[model samples]
Target: MFKNVLSENIWGRVVSEKEPVFEEINKIVESNSKLISKLNNEYHDHDSTIKLLSEITGQKVDDSVGVNLPLYSDFGKHLSIGKSVFINSNVMFTDLGGITLEDHVLIGPRVNLLSVNHPTNPEQRRGLIVSPITIKKNAWIGAAATVLPGVTIGENAIVGANAVVTKDVPANTVVTGSPAKVVKTI
Candidate 1:
């Protein structure tokens, strides 16, 4: 099903407020829920966790890629994670739009990578706005960070703990605080 729906423009096409894309999102989420359930269940064997993660992402993950338990995502099919990525516990990906984590990226605990937003208009607030999130090679997102829709974490950039990222982060910089601002260049 994921292979069938995966197209270059399919994600972009699903953004219309009037469309039934939300229903599609629910279907995808429902299909993937079993996998995530197994992942989080104590009864399941731990050895096959990586295989489950690969299935959820719809991509082959490197042997070096490591993710802690209890990872969460609403839509996992649209996620693209690269080699040697390390994602800690309690990471949530609202991947209705898409999420790309490039090689060697490190995601800290309790981080939220949100790819969906709502319109400000009272009548339209329930409507979904979708956007892709990209974390470039070697980017590090610290604990409890919330990365909003359409943002990019540049290569080797660091987002400090508890920061709220709302824009593109420049390469080789460190950002902290709400609506994260560049604090230093490393």
Candidate 2:
């Protein structure tokens, strides 16, 4: 499967015996919003903002500006977004591996779509798990919520606010709680 192959190829090179630093790959990977004050300017259009971000992260971003607010992702190099997706403020997407979001998705505030995680084995703690986060078409990830690695959020699913999703959310259902459960099926 491409997922496994992709993960193994990319994340295998991410971690080291010491902690991995973004600066180590700064030239290879893009992102310096903290260093460049202008990139953070609100005046930059969403498309332009994302474009600059792509240059910084070395990722490919398709169809930015689904909403007026600026979208931020470390995976601008690895993320491939779809059309008409309205994402709200303060979304932190760390796509060190890859993050693919399908069309017509709605994202709320402070939503974290992270793809990189460390292994449980302390002996092999240097190893990395780069699982791409896939939000299928028409999915809604709620506010201040966290979607863990390798979990596929199904099409048209509605994840409630502040939910911590540790598993795959089936399509057309509503999920909530710390380790989100199926609250309702829509």
**What overall lDDT goes with each candidate model?**
0.84, 0.71
1-186 in candidate 1: lDDT tens per residue? Answer: 123243334444335456565577677789899888878875544447778888887777667888888899888888888888899999999887789999999999999999888877778877777788999999999999999998999999999999999999999999999989999999
Off by over 4 Å in 1: 1-18, 43-47
TM-score winner: 1
- lDDT of model 2 at residue 183? 89
TM-score of 2: 0.77
Each prediction's number of clashing residue pairs: 0, 7
What tens digits encode model 2's per-residue C-alpha lDDT throughout 1-186?
A: 112212224554546545444334343333444523455555777677667655644544555436444456653456656767777877877766677778888889889998888878788676666777889999999988999887899999999999999999999999999999998999
Give the local distance difference test score of model 2. 0.71
lDDT comparing candidate 1 with the true structure: 0.84
List the candidates' TM-scores in order: 0.90, 0.77
